[model samples]
Target: MEILSNLALGFSIALSPYTLMLAVLGCFIGTIVGALPGLGPSNGVAILIPITFTMGLDATAALVLLTAVYYGAMYGGRISSILLNIPGDEPALMTTLDGYPMAKNGRPGQALVISGFASFWGALFATVMLALVAPALSRVAYQFGPAEYFALYLLAFSTLGGIASNNQAKAAFASCVGLGISVIGLDNFSGLPRMTGGNLHLMDGVDFLVAIVGLFAVSEVFFFIEKHGKGGAVGVKLNKFRVPWGEIWSTRWTQLRCGVVGFIAGVLPGAGASLGSFLTYMMEKNIAGPEGKFGTGVPKGVAAPEAGNNSAAGGALVPMLTLGVPGSGTTAVLLAVLMTLNITPGPTLFTDRPEVVWGLIASLLIANFVLLAMNVPLVRIFVKVLSVPPALLLPGVTMVSFVGIYSLTGGYFDLLLMILFGIMGYVFRKMDIPTVPVILGILLGSNMEDALRRAMVLSDGEWTYLFSSPIAIGLWIFAVAGFIAPVYFRNKIRKPQAVTD
Candidate 1:
């Protein structure tokens, strides 16, 4: 009954003409951004945040618009993945494995339609799950203390090595790099600069948006240049869009299973949509056995990851809204935006800012419907993004990224910092190092440090206090198990295949 009443209130606000229009506008803009390689949801939201302030919109409306863009970008990412063999964003990487092949096999239209439907179902299901789960979770989160929170952060960090990268050492190193970057601004406890090097800009530490745009967007430019303009053509000619009813029916179970998997993974801090999509694809391939045809135009292959990633996007919001811990890069930006608006997110947010919380939830549902309606009919148009020449596309993307960062900081120094990070990002990518852990580390490092210090202060510097609570102990145990479980399972699975061979 409480949920029902809140939904009523939420719908009333979300359905307002002004809020509805913002949602539509956000969705449209997000699709364009997502269709363009490298300009992901994070860049799209971060760029628009300053514009939102200038528009003088209320907090609820601003959040609604930004979050709609987040959802729309998730929906649109599959377009390039399917048609051009290029992932529009990191999470869409898994889709390219099967989606591109499907297109190459003369079924680009079917692939697009199927992926769109899969995305719709994933987003819709996850929105319902969010509505059901978040309120209760927020209440439970209210019970967490510094020790428990620190342990939870440990769990998030520990799991990343196993899920995000095959090379655990590289992931660990990337995380350390992020943590190191986070410590640059100041020693919050001592009120003294730690790594400022006498620069005022460094006193504030590295901006997350600057790091994101540089790593994902600018690094992409470097990568394109390295490719020397090769691989730019989309050989597959898309036919008129048609509903792939047969394909959808066939992959129904895969979509549902992956949707649930994606949502659960997204709820875990630092797991994000990339991990969710990868895990779902692997699971579907393994389960289908010989019949899966995973690499060569399997509808289920395309559907699973698309569904998983989109659902994970919804799942990522749960921790951000309920606990003030963002599960992904995009959610981290949303958290920053909320803080900028003077709306603190956490358990108290639910009670104190019911309108913002519920209205955003309602807007998510509306955005999913809008994406579904728009994506199917307009897929051909979206796919046309593939025809854009690399010379024009790369420079345009670079311009947008620079403009967005400049608008946000209004500083030439920040641009130089972004260029520096872009070089670092390109180097990291060329070396096969994963970037997500670094981003996650930067996002969570400060909060983790604060929790640890607070816990120590309470215990008079006794480290054992960090594990005194049952929740803390349990989380610590889970962290250890998460680190170990993947290796154990991999070896366990490989032995059987070895025996068969």
Candidate 2:
């Protein structure tokens, strides 16, 4: 009854002409950005954060547009991966392994069509899951103590290694660096500044947007410049967009299994589309037998990863919306945007911000259909986007990053920080040290500190309370496992592969 009422209200808000138009525009721009290599949803949305602020649009409208761009970009990202054998971002990497082979075999159009549809289905399934699960999850989060919340954040950061690179040490190092950077601002607990450098400007610490932009966008630009200098991109000619329903049906069980797997993975804190896709790919490969050729352009091969990634992207929203803890980088940006809007997300969000929450849910239903219509008929146009000269696009993206960071703080210092982090990001990218964990540390460190202090206060200086609650004990167990599981499993796999080779 409550959800129905919220949906009705959300429909009223989302159906407004202004919001609808903004949604359409955001979706179109996001698709274009996603279709272009090196410009995934994170960069696409970050570049536009300034634009959203400058326009002074309604927070709901701004969010609706931006998130639409996010999902739209995800849908479009499969295009280049399939046609050009190039993933637009790290998450799309799984898409290329089989998608490109299909394209190379003169089925570029078919591959794009299937991948796009798979993305749409995965997103739709996840959206429905969110609508059903978020309210319940929000209710559960209300029971959390600071200790539990802190443990949860620690668990989230630990999961980053699983989501990103298999290197636990590198991931931990990245997370530590982020925590150090996050502590640069005034200490909220001590009431005295720690790393302000005696500068009044540093009193507020670094803006999250500035850090995010520098880390993801500017860093990406520098890296791309080194690889694609003053040249055009490689192109592909898309032929026909056909579904081949029989082939799709043949993989129906695989698609459904992967879709469920993807959704479950998405619901986990810190797990995102990358983990979802990788897991789905591995699972399907193992499940395939003599009847299936595995990765050499089988339809199930494409469908599994596609479904998993799209579903995971949607599932990641569960924690972000219900508990205000992000499962991935892109969702972290969404949390930042929600904060900027002064709309708090947590157990009360569903009741307090029903329009924002349910409107987003309803809009997602519409957006999935919109993506299908757009990706199917416009497959050729998206393919041509690859032909866009890198010389032209790179400068525009870099300029956007510069302007966006500048607008956030209106300070040259922030600009300098952007450049510094941009270089740092470039170096991290080169070294293969996962950047996401750094973001995790920066975002979670303060919260962790807050929880620790609160838990200490409640225990009257006794530290044993940290392990008292069943929930806390459970979380600690999981956090320890998250740290150990990757190293153990990664080495286990590597040894066998090394022996086989």
Candidate 3:
């Protein structure tokens, strides 16, 4: 009954004229961003976050807009895969296997319509699950103290290396680099600067927004320019876009099963949409056996992965809203946003800022319907967005990154640091080091350190206290297993026509 009232409160905020308009605008922009190759939900949110800060939006409005963008990008990722045989982002890779084949059969519009329907059902299912699960999880987190929190942070990093990166060694290196960056400011315990090099801007450490823009948005700009504006090729133009209501009806079971698989995957702390899509595709393929014709562009093949990835995207929000641990790279960016707004995520968040949490939830529900309505009939407009040259699009994105970060901070040193981080990001990309863990480290490092310090103070400097609680012990075990489990599965997980990030 209380949850019902809370949801009603949420709907009231989400239905407001200002919030509804932002949701529509965010969905439109997010679809365009997702149609562009390489800028997935993570980059979409990061690029726009600084702008929200600059605009000085209230926390609820900012969250509503950005979350709309996140959900919209998940829907938009399929546009390129169905029509162009090019995945707009990593999770959309599986869509190409069956989607492109369907497109080649002169049914480009059918492939798209099917995928859109799958995306809607899958996301809707996960959103329902998230609503049911996050409050319970937050209640459990109320028992956590310093030892448990430090261990939770450790689990977050270890899981990222194990599940997010193909190479754990490189991910560890990136984690260390990010932690190093986090410690550059004044140390509260010592009351002295640690690694500031006597520079004034270093006093507050690296701003999360600046680092995010540099690593994601600016570096992407450099990559686009270097590749000579060849982000996507529309190999199969749509001759006609017809709604496939029968196809949608046929794959209802496939969507339900994939939604379940993807939502569970998303709720897990490091297994993201990539794994969800792959697992669901394989699950459907196995269920169909020899006659399913999954690889040759069957409708179920198009449905399975689309449902899985989009549902997983929604599922990834559960942990971020509950325990402050991001379940995916994009959720990590959203975590940065919440922190920047001075809204610490944990058990109290629901009680302390129910409006923000409930409003964002309501907005996601609204955005899902908005995306379905817009995508079903108007997908042709998003497909045309692919024709816009990366050369023209990237510079404007870069300018936003520069201008947004500067306006928010007003620090010349931050601009220079951003450029340096951009260069560093390019180098990291060249080296095949995943940048997500680095961002996670910066977001969680200080809090982890504080937890450790508090634990030590309570335990009188005893190391054993770090593992004193059952939650702490479980987190340690989970962290270790999370890192090792990926190694065993890394060889078996296939990436058919996988696009490099």
Candidate 4:
């Protein structure tokens, strides 16, 4: 009954003309950002944060708008993945595996429609789960100590390396690189620079936004030039937009299963949508038996990852809202926005600022519907984005990235940093070393370090304190098991197939 009342209050605020309009506008902008390669939800929200301040809206409305953009961007990323074989963002990478193949087979319209529906189901299911489960989960999270938090972070790193890539060594190396970057600034405990190279800007550590833009947007430009030459571009044909209702219906079980898996993954810190999508795709491949032509553009291929990523997006918000801990890069930005507004997230956020919490929840539900409605009829228009020449598109993307990063820091140094990372990203791509783990490492490194430091302080440097709590021990056990489970299961599954062959 209380939940109903809270939801009613949320709807009342979310349905207001101003808030509703912002939601629609956010969805529109997010789709465009997501469709464009390199500029993702993090960039979209980070770039727009200043504009939100200038609009003079209250905290609730500003958050509603930004959160909508986040959700919209997730929906938009599939556009390029399916149409052009370019992932709009890291999370959409898996989509390219089957999405491009499906489009190439001349089911472009069906592919788009199927992904749209899958994204819708994923977002809707996760949002509903957020509404129902967050309160209870928040209560559990409230009991966490520094040790528990550190253990949880370890779990994230352990599971992430295996799940993010087939090459655990590369992932671990990338994660270590990210951790090294995270420690570049002044140490909080000792008040000394760790790896600043004595530069002034290095004293503040690397800006997350700067790194993200360089690694994704700027690196993409380099790859685009290399792959397509100066003037070449991939051309896509658009058939009449049609919903494959029958095909989508047949994959309902896959969608549901993947959605659940994605939501659970999202709820774990640092797991993010990319991991969720990858895990679900692998799961579906295993379950679909011999007939699942996953790599050849199967409908379920598109559906599973799309659902998982969107659901993971929704799940990422849970920890951010309830525990004041962001599960992904984008949510980290959202957390900063919340802090800037003087609205601290965590358990008290529910009681103290019911309006903001519930209103944001309500807006998410509305935004999902908005994205679905907009995507279906307007997909043909989105597909047209693929027709733009690389020479033109690449330059435009570079300009947008520069403007967005400059707007945040107002420094040329950051611009140079962007280019440097861009080159590094390009090199990493060429070497087949995954860059997502690098980003994840940077994102989670500081938090893990802080948690570990705090735990040691509490225990007078006793290492056993890290596993003092049942929760902490359980998390450590899971971390070790998760790291080994994938390799074990892969071998088990493949061995039987080899025998049959």
The TM-score-based order of candidates, best leading, equals: 3, 2, 1, 4
Minimal lDDT window, size 10, model 3: 492-501
Q: Which TM-score value belongs to model 2? A: 0.94
**Candidate 1 clash pair list:** none
Runs in model 4 lying further than 4 Å from the true structure: 37-62, 85-107, 190-194, 229-236, 241-247, 278-302, 323-353, 487-501
lDDT of 1 by residue, 1-501 (tens): 999999989999999999999999888878777777756777667667666765678999999999999998898888888887877777888898899999988889899899999999999999999999999999998889999999987787777655555556776788889888888897889989878889898998888767766776787788888897787545578876567898899999999999999999899876778767878988899999987789898999999998999999999999889988777768877877787688978899999999999999999899888888778887666767656777897887778778877877898999998888789888987776767667667767888899999999999999999989888899899888876776767655321110000
Could you give candidate 2's per-residue lDDT for residues 326-419 as a string of tens digits? Answer: 8777887777788778887788888887888999888777777878888877766666778877778888998988887776667799888888
**Candidate 4 clashing pairs?**
none
lDDT of 2 at 373: 85
The local distance difference test score of model 3 is: 0.86
Ranked candidates (lDDT, high to low): 3, 1, 4, 2
Instruction: State which candidate has the highest lDDT.
Output: 3
- Count of backbone clashes for each model? 0, 0, 0, 0
* Reference-based lDDT, each prediction: 0.82, 0.79, 0.86, 0.81
Highest TM-score: which candidate?
3
Model 4: lDDT of residue 499: 7
lDDT, candidate 4, residue 114? 91
List candidate 1 stretches off by more than 4 Å: 49-57, 487-501
lDDT of 3 by residue, 204-237 (tens): 8998778888888888888887888764664787
